[model samples]
Target: MSRQLLQEPVQDLLDALTKSEGPDILSTFTTSPKPLAHEHGLPQLAPFLGRSFHGQEGISAYFDLLSTYLQIENMKFEPEETWVIDESCMAIALRGTATFTWKETQHSWEETFAYRIKVAEDVSDDSEKNGSLKVCEYQIWADTGAAYLASLGNLDDMPE
Candidate 1:
């Protein structure tokens, strides 16, 4: 697909993320009734990290944990840098500054991260962007070190 064909879907997904509410973003993911997210539940790595968020209910739980424990402020993605690999896959690295806070510890710091996303056409309701693209998978490559330190309330103390 041409980059132009994906601009709307990508922008819509990003907007949903910025909104950061579970319901607001779920539609951006898909219109199918089946579970869409597949994640490796990494509880040992972070408290908010769920093993896998399956369906809508699971998605809600996943976001709840995140909202309860972390605050992502000013998170930005470089659209110009998004690498579209065929029509079903894309790799886009986060190249902007964002303050990530572990809410329980009140630890906040800026970090750069990356994520890979997959988008596909959804022929569901026109309400979902008139059969435009929908996100199939979203994989985050966050700064685990920073996340861990922040979770322990020690990120700020770590030296650059």
Candidate 2:
């Protein structure tokens, strides 16, 4: 029932990722163009560079660029919130799923990532954009599902 036990599956991966602030995350990748991108630190993206691919690389790249453009000030995990620890130490990945979609608006992109956050309250409906989900980044990063859970309880100013 501990945090470590619950994070067993994506514990190391997500932990390593989340530990780095968004600005730090941007610096590491933006300057390099290609670095330890995957969970295993693989350089497989170079070969597929000129080619077209729709995966984490593109999305991560977009985030990096967006972070740079926004001049993000700070990035930190929700400190005071309660993490959904598992009932047992030897349980599966105590994480949920998320989906993101973006569309080209008049002058910029309108992006939204829907999530199924596991909060203390029954907020399945509150995760929607119109609900209690706190949006970020000129409302471009408006998340409605697990993203809300991932970003829960964090009180940093908008990244701008």
Candidate 3:
């Protein structure tokens, strides 16, 4: 039987995110005519936290920061739940794991995280109806405490 509407595209997006560069991550987002298409966007954690990363450039920069400071390995998804947002649309909360490192301190940890992925509403050039999921917004629920301590160069050394 054919795959479900979300399974295939979401999987593709997750795979794209695992690439060694940010363009692949950018490619998964919805298209826009003007700049700042994403006026308000994701990630509510230290390092990538705050509202500074608003548009495509900001999003790209976010990835740049990640590349500069953090390392992700063996990225994979463990589906937890999927729910509808509206007709012909849905969102997912899934568990993800990766070996994350703070490149500055050469500190690494096995992290289990999550994402609240919201499907992009309108991306004329790259429509999700064509079977590719376009992301509008996603909130990352990662190990911020570890990342915070990692940024300080003592993640493992911190008290339990």
Candidate 4:
């Protein structure tokens, strides 16, 4: 796709992340519903997750865990660098420091946040812009985050 076509979507997604607008940002990126587990179960387990297996999952899971951790640590985003691009896919790389409101929690917290995410639009064989814009592998990434991370264990993992 021409780099110009991706500009708006990339900017909008980055703005959503910078503002920490949860469902708003997620909806643009996924087809499946946001799983209820992270919403209902996170706050209760916030203080206990440091030893949790983070890297075992993909980047979205990492972000979920990271988001939960930020809430626990009371960190807020203070974006440093924000760049938008359209290479093989539309992407945005953002870096920022999080400012924390210290709570009584024992976890040592930093007053900064840094993140880099790439958001791309799905282009199917029947998509309107298929010939004008680069097709993106967005569905592959979305399927994993929307379906896989919410499950946490194999019992809930979506079958290929």
Candidate 5:
């Protein structure tokens, strides 16, 4: 597939999340009963923060955890680099910025993200088809200290 075609699903997912459309966000995944891994790379701030999730259930749990602290108004993802690993796989390096209400205080954050996505084959059987291109792995690296302080509504402690 072309790069533009490969990027469409990812862009769709980002758009849905930016709009806070939960159902649309969830539809970008495959329902193959396989495990999907998502890792958040901030741990020192909150105990429940920066956890790794697996499978659809784990994905739902991760979203639930995020909803408690983050009321995101907008999330914009810009692909800084992209590499096609093969016909069925691709990796995208993204720089993302978001404006959100965290812990009742509005804040904005910028992060570097990486996504490894796999394009599912079009099989005849519904059960056999894995659906569309789905994000198999997502990793985020951000300023943990700032995000931590924001989560506590302590803007004064945040670095300049």
Candidate 6:
């Protein structure tokens, strides 16, 4: 697999996620199944908020929790920079905007997100039985305080 080939699967996964389609997103994972780790940097006050999720089931649960607190009206990603570290690894510096409704308060968040994705070992094979490339790790560096406030209907206290 060439470096250029690595970008397709990552882009496909991002597209599925931006659409908020759980099933479609899950189809991109490897056959042996690895955890899709999501880490959120939140204040100590939000203990119920999860900092990590494991496997497909955990990933599903995480998405379910997110849906309960907010509805993503729109999500767009602009890759300002991307590095193909290898045939199976890639990193992207993406700037994106998300318009969502939290606690009935609509808000738009524009931030830069970093992603490190790894393709499955068998991804080089185009056979149907072969596994697909998936995101093994994802990290979001965003203003969680504003999100938390919005979720609690405390928009008045949110930073400008």
Question: Which regions in candidate 5 have their CA more than 4 angstroms from the true location?
Answer: 20-23, 33-37, 79-88, 104-131
> Candidate 4's residue-wise lDDT over 1-160, tens digit each?
5555655554555455556554354433422211111221242334323232211133256456546534433333333233445457455443344433212332232333333334344443444533332212121111223212333333234465
lDDT of each residue in 1-160, candidate 1, tens digit only:
7666655555677777776552377666655433345434456878645366665576667678778878889977775544544544543333445788888889888877665566667655556454557675666656777778888988878777
Candidate 2 global lDDT: 0.27
lDDT tens digits, residue span 1-160, model 5: 6766667666665666776554464555555544354545556775445777665677667677778776655566664254434444555555666655566666555544444555343332465444456555555565566667777778665567
In model 1, the worst 10-residue window by lDDT is: 87-96
Return the lDDT, model 5, position 135: 56
Model 3, residue 68: distance off in Å is: 1.3
Pairs of residues clashing in candidate 1: 41-51
Which of 1 and 5 is the better model by lDDT? 1
Candidates in order, TM-scores: namely 0.77, 0.26, 0.72, 0.39, 0.71, 0.72
Write one digit per residue (lDDT tens) for candidate 3, span 23-72.
Answer: 47666655552112121223444556544455567667777887888888
RMSD in angstroms between candidate 3 and the native structure over all alpha carbons? 5.0
What is candidate 6's CA lDDT for residue 154?
78
On lDDT, the candidate that comes out on top is 1
lDDT of 2 by residue, 1-160 (tens): 3444333322333343455532332222211112222111122322212222223365356455334332222222332133333343322222222222211111122233221111111123223312221101100123222222223322123343
Better by lDDT, candidate 6 or 5: 6
| Candidate 6 lDDT, 1-160, residue by residue in tens | 6555666666777777776544486666543445465646763524325477666676667677677766675677766244535653444334556765674566444444455566554443447736655565555555576677666667666557
Alpha carbon lDDT of residue 132, candidate 6? 55
Identify the runs in model 4 with alpha carbons over 4 angstroms from their true place.
2-4, 20-23, 32-67, 72-86, 101-114, 123-160
Please give the TM-score that candidate 2 achieves against the real structure. Answer: 0.26
Q: What lDDT would candidate 6 get against the real structure?
A: 0.59
- Find the 10 residues in a row with the least total lDDT in model 4: 134-143
lDDT of each: 0.64, 0.27, 0.61, 0.36, 0.58, 0.59
